[model samples]
Target: MESALSHRRFGSSDLMVSPLGLGTVKLGRDKGVKYPKDFTIPDDKAAADLIALARDLGINLIDTAPAYGRSEERLGKLLQGQRQDWVICSKVGEEFNNDSGDSHFDFSHRHTRQSIERSLDRLKTDYIDIVLIHSDGRDEHIIQHEGALEALQQCKQEGLIRAIGMSTKTVSGGLLAAELSDAVMVAYNPAHQEESPVLDYCARHGKAAILKKALGSGHLISEQDPAQAAMHFALSHPGVTSAIVGTINPEHLRENAEACQRALLQT
Candidate 1:
């Protein structure tokens, strides 16, 4: 199963990525999740199968974060031989405490550098394709006051990261991130379009816009053909470089990939 999905330029970066990225939040942690139902963490074999299935279905991008429990560590083991086959996107600024089932935020210069270094070791990679600041709802403050993205820029210059941006929670933050970085992860779906302006800005400025919660974070599951409908709506926008869908289920992964291919074709 060679990649059948077309690759798109990730903003101004040298790397090309698949439009449908595999989000790995479910791969590591189950507690503190907002999914419609609770799920058990998959074992090693199951995790490996899901990763392989994603590659076979033409997905080349994998999104994980330090807040996503052991996702980076597990991926480090699972992707040992196929590192170059995927464009890995990890995050900093937020750390999940497994013991407390809570998350804490850190946007300082020193913490930013340490986070990236830890991610590189956890993923067993020399460099990450993209590293976004996992915002803690204070998008404006984080960009303007916290100086997190600036730290990421330094890492990029040092060749530790290929691209930098923020998973912004607001339109203003999304736009600001696009202005300062190579890409942004924005939440956009039929149920919520408040960040469409961010997408428009990305389209006009040639910045990469990766969609988060494109399926309404499973809230849209009741809709008919939810995966196809959600994916089509998200990718129809010329601004969206890719949409991250976090599903450990093989059937759902295939459906999402097919839906994205159809949407890209129509576009």
Candidate 2:
């Protein structure tokens, strides 16, 4: 667990997170859009052990969403009282509607409220450290659903969330959210650096820029040396406050932490 990796400030929020955060989307049973055959859902005990290993390695940020099947519930049951020193970030505006057999986004205020309550219940927490509006690059969906953003703002005012952010696929979507929200989480990496401008905008506005899909959804780590190079490339970006990499393996977690340290040393 001992390494040279250290913590950094998470944008304007008072919370400080490790450069490498845990992404729990894969922990969920339902893998939307992607082929189900590729999904690897970890057992509850294995997931808990992974979290404990990450904590021991000095990582404190855990990002999950209600749309991610049973991930929240599993995290709740595993890391409940054992993890008091962690920062948990979850997203609203999306849900796993079993009737549709797919996840759907509903930015309605009613859905937002329900999503937050459900996330709280599943996470077994009173307040979430960060709440993000998960948008999949749909302008019409976002413009038509102003109430969802307003609901997040209201939640921030009510102290249900420490900070509000937008998770989107496009730069424009992220930029729009950066202007309206407290932080922005977007897909960023060496191969696809289209979100650089959005990251700069977030940096200028004092909003956190969280990098998602940092390894291009496991493409970067398909090989050994490339994985380290990809991690270094993502963390080398000045605007990225942290990179959330999905993995339930403690060995991979340790390797990623070492990669971050290597990146720091190289810089």
Candidate 3:
């Protein structure tokens, strides 16, 4: 029994993701985060339970990255039984050291291919639903000079990735990425609206635009229900395919989903 909310499609890609994808950053990395409060990473049981809850709540998209502590690995194990139910979005280029909490990125041909293969192994999946270049603020340089984008295209051709995109930093880079990739993840919230141009491009082109940091990465703390407002704003945009919101707490996850439900109903 799939929730109707899971049936929304992302442009021409085969990925029919949920209108509100669940972000798994809090599931993996707690350090170097923008969350207002500190939290211990959930244990394996808790993680598995949370994924199950998300599915029951009609969320089909799960965003993960190697840069997140062990999110891919944990999901690999936790989501073992029903692989078809999820549209998992993983990343390349950035790898975080668990012990040091430090990160390094590589977008060369060799590394990009190697990283995707490793991601497939870690995710315990035959093919990843989406693979985004986790840009390090050098969005244009990475897309133009680096071999990552080319590798992703090759992977798509080889049937390893369903779609390819970039979690872009700059507007120009985002526009370029929208031109080249299947999707683009941009940071757009009420507090920051710099990426509207990118959203506009995606809408105009029928490319998928996934909004990240919709709640300002937990920094937009005010009493006016910022989470609801942010989700509404992100989805209200014609270009936005879905809003990715991450939370470790089951209660918070449900609350966020309710907010998304409200947001979707508004239009």
Candidate 4:
């Protein structure tokens, strides 16, 4: 059967993405995460198998970041010869130091440009589908004072990125990002609804709202089929375009996709 989960336009951009995007943070990094438990990074063969499974389940959007240690590089190797089959979403402004297991932020113009170019090189792609500013809690200040967004806008103009936005950390930041960019990613789930105003604003303003931590970063899960309930709650919001669920488990990915499909149908 064809997928019940249909693709939606990402804001006003021409990129059509499935409602459930594959987040790849777990595919590369295992340290400095907020998950309920620890996990080993999947080997190349396992990662390739997981990617194939995601495609088979009708997921086209793959979310990654420089903060996701080795994610872009691994994807570059695994996604060889199949670049057209995925819409890659990457991030800048936050870099994960593998040796120290610490994260640092830089949203300056030079760092922003360097990050995009480095991502392009690591992904082995000429252009990325979407690029978001990885926030450091100072969402409002980052949007206003930093040059990352401006650099991303220039990248879009120059065709290095198809779309640019911020994975915002605040309601005000989300609203401002939506007004200035093609999309804004905010955290929204049953456990966290403080960002719903951002989604509502996106719904009314024709801006795309991409959700992160839709499962409460794996803390809100309880009982059987919690993914189904959590996904239903996230996707039921009218402003939501897609929710990025990071998992390296094949069974979990399939379950997440099915849950997303069921949620879309019910809504």
**Per-prediction TM-score to the true structure, in the order listed:** 0.98, 0.92, 0.97, 0.98
Decreasing lDDT order of the candidates: 1, 4, 3, 2
lDDT of 4 by residue, 1-267 (tens): 446457889988999998999999988888899898889999998999999988888899999999999999999999999999899999999999988899999999999999999999999999999999999989889989989999999999999999999999888988989999999999998888998999999999989889999988778857776789999999999999999999998988888999998898899
| lDDT per model vs. reference | 0.93, 0.81, 0.90, 0.92
Worst lDDT run of 10 residues, candidate 3, spans 1-10
Q: For model 4, what is the C-alpha lDDT against the true structure?
A: 0.92
Q: How much lDDT does candidate 2 score? A: 0.81
Q: What lDDT score is found at residue 115 in candidate 2?
A: 87
Off by over 4 Å in 1: 1-3, 221-223
The TM-score, computed over Cα atoms with residue i paired to residue i, of candidate 1 is 0.98
Whose TM-score is higher: candidate 1's or candidate 3's?
A: 1
What is the alpha-carbon lDDT of model 1 when measured against the actual structure? Answer: 0.93
Model 4, position 220, has a per-residue lDDT of 83
Writing each residue's lDDT as its tens digit, candidate 1 over 75-109 gives: 99999999989999999999999888999999988
Over 4 Å off, model 2 = 33-39, 98-101, 139-145, 221-224
Worst 10 residues of 2 by lDDT: 30-39
TM-score of 4: 0.98
lDDT of 3 by residue, 87-198 (tens): 9999999989988878999999899999999999999998999999999999999999999999999999999999999999999999999999999999999898999999
Model 2, 1-267: lDDT tens digits are 366358888887788888888988778754453532375688877888888788888889899988777888888888877657788999987778545658777888888888898888989988899899888578435745567888888888988889888898777788888887778898887678888998888767787888988877776544457667888888777778888988876798888888877887775
State the TM-score for model 3.
0.97
